[model samples]
Target: MSSHVYVAFDLGAESGRAVAGIYDGQKLELKTLHRFPNTPLRLPDALTWNVLRQYAEILQGIALAV
Candidate 1:
């Protein structure tokens, strides 16, 4: 039998994560590869997501998958 691998990225308002799914022709198994907080910077007038940090987290997730 053969197996298939799949990767998924789940992003939300407060956090994000990377998950891996392994399918063996019948069922699927899921694993959380990485997780990080999606923190927003508070400023005097507005708030914004830490995009750079998020990017780094995404890269880390990919590295883990590799």
Candidate 2:
């Protein structure tokens, strides 16, 4: 038996992406589903992630993976 793993999100401070990996042998095959800009915004000495946009991207990635 074998298993495949799909990553739907990777939100970094400057960037984010969705990656997929196939595990069958000693070597693993990787694939990218989506890559987008994920820069944090700073205003009034506060920083935050665009949660709405991020969630939309994540859903898109999941749809693509499926």
Candidate 3:
């Protein structure tokens, strides 16, 4: 028998998460690998996503998944 792996990213307005799924022919199992806040930065005049931080979180999530 062989197994398969899958990853999913759920990015919402205020938060984000990474999940992993493993399947073996009939059933699937899921696990939450990482979660981080998708907070916006309050700049001098406007709000914006902290993109660098979000990128780092994504990397961390990938690491966890691996």
Number of the predicted model whose TM-score against the real structure is largest: 3
Model 3 local distance difference test score: 0.91
Model 2 lDDT on a 0 to 1 scale: 0.81
Q: Model 2, 1-66: lDDT tens per residue?
A: 576775657898888899888677566888998998886666798989888888888888888787
Worst 10 residues of 3 by lDDT: 3-12
Q: Which is the winner by TM-score between candidate 1 and candidate 3?
A: 3
**Which window of ten consecutive residues has the lowest lDDT sum in model 1?**
3-12
State how far residue 22 of model 1 sits from its true place (Å).
0.9
TM-score for each model? 0.81, 0.72, 0.85
Q: Candidate 1's C-alpha lDDT?
A: 0.90
Evaluate model 3: give its TM-score: 0.85
Candidate 1: tens digits of C-alpha lDDT, residues 1-66 = 898878888888999999989899999999999999999888899998888888899889888987
- List candidate 3 segments past 4 Å from native: none
lDDT of 3 by residue, 1-66 (tens): 798888888888899999999899999999899999999989999999998988899889888877
Poorly placed runs, candidate 1 (over 4 Å): none
